[model samples]
Target: MDKLEAKNRIAELVQLLNKYGHEYYVLDQPSVPDAEYDQKMQELQRLEAKFPALVSTASPTQRVGGEPLDKFQKVEHHVPMLSLGNAFNEADLRAFDRRVTQLAAEPVVYICELKIDGLAIALTYENGTFVRGSTRGDGRVGEDITSNLRTIRSIPLTIQEKRSIEVRGEAFMPHHSFLALNKGREEKGEMVFANPRNAAAGSLRQLDPKVAASRNLDIFLFGYGKWEADSLPSHSERLKYLAALGFKINPEWKRCTTIDEVIEYVSYWSTERPNLSYEIDGIVIKVDDLQQQEKLGFTAKNPRWAIAYKFPATEAVTKLRTIELSVGRTGVVTPTAILDPVQIAGSTVQRASLHNEDLIKEMDIRIGDTVVLKKAGDIIPKVVRVIEEKRTGDEVEFSMPKQCPSCNSELAHLEDEVALRCLNPNCPAQLKEGLIHFVSRDAMNIDGLGEKVIEQLFQAKLIKTIADLYRLKKEELLKLDRMGEKSVQNILNAIEASKSNSLEKLLFGLGIRHIGAKAAQTLAAHFHTMDELCEATYEDFIAIDEIGEKMADSIVQFFSEEKVIELLQHLSTMDVNMTYLGPTQSQMTAIFSNQTIVLTGKMESFTRSEAKKLVEANGGSVTSSVSKNTDIVIAGEAAGSKYKKAQELNIPIWDEQKFKEAIES
Candidate 1:
């Protein structure tokens, strides 16, 4: 076919496939058979190949084409995705209804939706085209998962409405998908996911979109976010509008005029949830009227107009086979229960947390005794209590090990602490755990060096410290299992790249006693050099915001250690960058210095990270949201919401050309 003919045919096929896909994946109704669908999809792919320019991201064949990302880029949400206060019992629901009545001041109408047990994701569409998708990381920021989300058939690539909108939803793995995935994993000798929620989350977080596509995940658009105009009076109507826009929303939602009706819906779902193909942990009750919801407003963490009525936690009685103790990075010895196989929350419960010696003693949990296990909201099951009535005389009492399990060093319990800790810094268990943390995403972000590889390297005695990772030779790596020449080279490159990372990453990766990622960032931003930070006294650390007396002491103690000082010297000698590379206002560039700038859309010359770094390196604060406070908005090709917001707010605007010129000047 000619280009024009191919274009028209492609459009027709897209419409047919979208319709068929919506029916099959969202509505659970199939109009076309698998063979027919496959034939049409093949035709579309061939046509697109012939007319390469016609290949759109929204095209059916383009759903899963992308390189496996080294890491996900963090995207800050203009609006925060907040959590909900949970109502466990009928009394909590009643109390929630009473609070809504008192606060809303208007007659309350409620919209109830099944709280799908899965990962919450936000999808952003610009002029009806799906542009971005992200996990609700800390609500303020999230990891970009657009490629993975595109593979989901239920999520439309484009809508009829030509408006920029942000949709929030729960991405879930259905029962059949979960079972099939686990079975496949078992056959491959890979550890199977404990629950459908975990499977869904794991799929979404996969670096490769093809892997996510194979998982067959689905989504239910629950609400809207960051939309400029939403004139629908009630949330129920908004849901209808979203459905009209070709977005998949849960069909089981109901509008309740009274709390009694809401309660009925919750009660109905509590028992009936088991019958559904997908998993749901609770019922979300929200005030139907948008205006009323606004009037009721939100608290610090959750909305006052909404509450989640959690189904009572699933519990099962199982025999406590034995308690297993594991050492952690911090040297804290944790106790886990190895239980007799019993089904709880639709998963086989073979392992549960015993939570240290105090908890075991407190519950009087003896081995071979019947124990009640509680699985709450798909979280790891915990040993709730021992069934004393069912206990036999032959049951064995468990005791905590007095010595470090790995090194045989004597374990010491610090005063005011319940759990025993292994103080040996050189303990193999501690080093392994610390190495894992050192290479984690939030830390040094060394790709290819994952937990399994770290364990292997540790066991091989090739790496005992974080610095040893930098010293990894390509030759030595080739000797390891599954380490091909290409993979080893990639790992070496990643290790090399991590050297230039901002000091905050190195600080967090160091596994200091009380220094977390945020605290590390604060410290790095303040001192700007590792040597300076090392010189910081307890008083100096205490003066910083968010650093408490305990953290300050910990920092001082950590830096004072001779081993830590030597480690720093070794890393520096290996050419690892120790100076903070992030922006400081005292730096040059009058245009960007101290300015809060927003960047939007695609840049031909620079990646988002490259642009962000340059802007930061020039002493500008690169913000995600555009508002009256924004000093400038750098509009790249096809700039979207932030550009429009900047225009609306009359903020100073810069095209990519102007931005480049300014930075160069």
Candidate 2:
């Protein structure tokens, strides 16, 4: 076909294919067979390849996916994706309804929807063409996963309505997809995902869109961030309009005129949820009237007009066969109950966390006793309680191990802490866990060095410490099982790349007793270099607002360790970065310099972390709570107790926009 003919034909094919895909994937009703859709898509692909100039980014053929991305870019949301407060029972729902009614001063109609247990995402369309898609990282800023999202057939590349809009939705893996994915992983000898939610999240976060497409991810658009169209009066009407605009709206949603009706809907779905192909943890009820929703506003973290009624966790009774102990990177020994295989919340439960020795003692848990098994938040398996009535005289009481399971080192319980810890710096279990932490995503982030690879290397005696990872040669790596030329090169490159990471990453990777990622960042920003941090006195650390006495003591103790100092020196010799590279305390001493600032509520432009970072970068110190000494309080939507407290203290308050302008200035 000629250029003009190809353009018209491509447009026609795109519309037809998108419609068919929507019908099949979203509505679960296919008008055309797979072969018919495939033929049309193939024709479109052939024409697009012949006439490359005619191809558009939003073309249906592009849904097959593109080249892998190096990393996801950050995208600032135009509107904050506020999280919903949860209602556990009928009373909570009633209370939520009462609050909405009281605030609106009218009888409020509610829109109840199945809260899809999946990753929340925001999609922005420019003139009906999908422009960008992002993960709701922290409400305001998110990672741009546009390429990955495009692979989802339910998410239309172009909407029927020719208008700029931003819609929010849950991207999920169906039950079949999750099962298939886990089966595939099991076959490959890879760790299986715990649940569909985790599977969906992992698939979406993949660097390659092809990987995401293979996972068979789907989405249901529920709400709009920005709608540049004719105004809708109610949320129920908006849902209808969204469907009309070729968006996938969840069919399970209902409109309730009264609180009792809402309660009925919730109760009906609580049992019916398991029948659906997709997973849903709860029911999300929102005020039907948009005007009422607007008036009701939001709280610090969630919307006041809506609340999620979470279904009570699924439970099963099983015999506790034995107790297993494992040591974490922090050297804390944790007990896990090995149970007789039982199913709970759609997954088999063979083991559950006993948390610590105290939990076992408090619950009077014993091996050979019947125990109630339940998923904490329908994710992690936990032992709820012991069936005391079923307990026999032959049951064995479990005790905490006196020595480290891996290294046989004496374990000591720290003062004021419930967990008994192995104090041995050279503990093999601690070293292995520490190495795993060092290469983790938020730490040094050596991409190809997964848990399996780390274990393999440790077992083979190839790597004994974090610094030894850099010393891995391609020849030696190739000798290991499953380590091909390409894999070795990728791992080597990742290791080399990790050497340039900021000091905070290295600090966090060290697995200090109480130092977390955020704390590491704070310390890195404060000290600027590893040497400076090592030289910093306990008094200097405690002087910082966020650093507590425990953290300060830990930092001092960690730096004082001769072995740790040697390790730092060895890493330094290998050209590993030791300096802070991120935005630090500015020397300019701007308006916010030395000012105690507290950020509360949800900001449209900046997430809480971003706001805190910004405040600190401008020489300001951010505090968690409102205090008498607080100089300023930046309050956003639904600023609750913090705002009220700020008002009481007569402290100056700034809105999100105001804070933005100040930071910009």
Candidate 3:
């Protein structure tokens, strides 16, 4: 074939291969045989090799994987990926429904979806082409894992529409994939992962994308983060739109008009969760109408419009071998139950959290006694209760230590908290834990500075304070065991890169008591500079929304410390960035300012999200429902109940063309 013909054939093969792969992986229906798919893929690869410049990023051959990354870069989310509050039982779900009704002041419609037991990820598309994919780290910032995400055949490399958008989803491993992976690991005599969720997370985090590709991973797009198009007011409509755009959305989502239907959905899913090919820890219930979600807003950590109804945890019996104590960064002494290895759920259970001494006494959990263990949220393992009937008289009672295990400092029990705390600020254990937090992904984001590396540096006395990290030399890092020249350089480079991070990162890394990541972002944005933040009083902090009295006091108290002041000075000398660089909220002033508009039916000229954006750009808000307060309702072809309601309320209505002209004019 000629060069041009080869290019054309490559394109055809790429499309065919992608279609066949998607059909098999996502639709679970293969129209073409595997041999035909393989033949096309092989042809595409050969053509791409002959004409390297013609190879596209979206080509099916590219999914084989690329060179390993030294580290994943941090990506800032345009829209915060908020977590959901939990509902343990029927009462909790009912309470959630009541709260939604009271807030919305209308009968609520809900969309119930299986809360996939997997890693939460955000995929960004620019002009229909996948640009980036990231882990949902602390909501605001995430680790860029685009290479790994590309390997998932179900995830489209390009969409049907050419638009900029961000979609959120759960990337998971199927039960079969998990079993096969673990069986392979067992045969290879390697450590097996605990569950499908863990296996998926671990696979996605691989430095090499080829490793991730080998592990069969799939994704179910749940919602959009940002859709730069016309708006769809209902959540269900959005799902349909995403599917139309060539995204794989979970088909199990159901729209329920009332709380009773939601409850029924939840109850049915609770029993059916295990029967599915993939794991589902809970059912997510969300208000179907986008307007209700907007009106409900969000709490500090979660959305008020949605709640997750968690299934009861899977349980297993095991013998408690011993009790171990560990100190946290806050100096809280926590008890951990060391158990005789037993398989529970999908993984082996060797240890479970005891929570505190009070819990130990309440449960009468003695060492050498048989105990029932369960995973809380299918992630954290905890002792449910002691299997008293199975226990013998030889069981030994456990006790909480009076002193800190690591620092030998006297432990103090606070009146308000259950866990005993080590009040010594100079404790080595606290410093180590603080260092670990400082270099964490959401904090300083210093890649290659994991817990093991941090522990090694601390033990070697190469690093004493957070500021000491900036003073480390390449030679010093080389002294550590297993530290290669390349690894040391990477660590040094990460430390240097972290210096340019926004003030929020530094604030969170400081390990300030009562100040979480979100609060740090709020404070950073408000103050703009660390110097301004340091000078702010308790009143200044309290004035900010979401900054409570305790957090305010902690901020003021943290800044007041001489050591903290010294640390800040040293960091400033190192030329670390102290200002916020994220997008700031700007005031809107336009023709549609403060107007409540409702769009209904089909638009010939613009997509739903596009129309919504046009209205918002002109300073108007688009709502899902037609209410008495609605100022204008845009009716398109086959306008439905919203159109009739707007007419009854004597609200102004505009056709699709008229609406377009108004926005344009």
TM-score attained by model 3 = 0.56
Local accuracy of candidate 3 as per-residue lDDT tens digits, 1-665: 88899888888887788778778877889999888888777778788888998999889878765899999989989998766777778998998999999999988899999999899999999998999999987566789999999999999998888899999999999988998998999887566888888899999999999999999999999998987757688999999999888889999999998889999998898777657888888899999999889999985446889988877778878889999998899999899999988755556679888989999999998999988888874568888888788866999998888888988889998768988999999889899999999999778989999887888999999888999999999988887788899999999999999999988889999999988776776788788898899899989889986699988988898899999999999999999988987644353237687899999875646767668756765668789999999999997643545765787698888876577677666
1 against 3, candidate with superior TM-score: 1
Q: What lDDT score belongs to each candidate, Candidate 1 first?
A: 0.86, 0.87, 0.86
Pick the TM-score winner.
Answer: 2
Rank all candidate structures by their lDDT, best first, as comma-separated numbers: 2, 1, 3
* lDDT for each residue of candidate 1 in 45-141, tens digit (9 for 90 to 100): 8888888898877787778998899889999888888777667788888888888998876679899999998999999999989999999875667
- TM-score per candidate, chains pooled: 0.68, 0.77, 0.56
What lDDT, from 0 to 1, does candidate 1 have?
0.86
lDDT of 1 at 97: 88
Residue 34 error for model 1, in Å?
2.1
Number of the top-ranking candidate, with lDDT as the measure:
2
Considering lDDT, which of the candidate structures 2 and 3 is the better prediction for this target?
Answer: 2
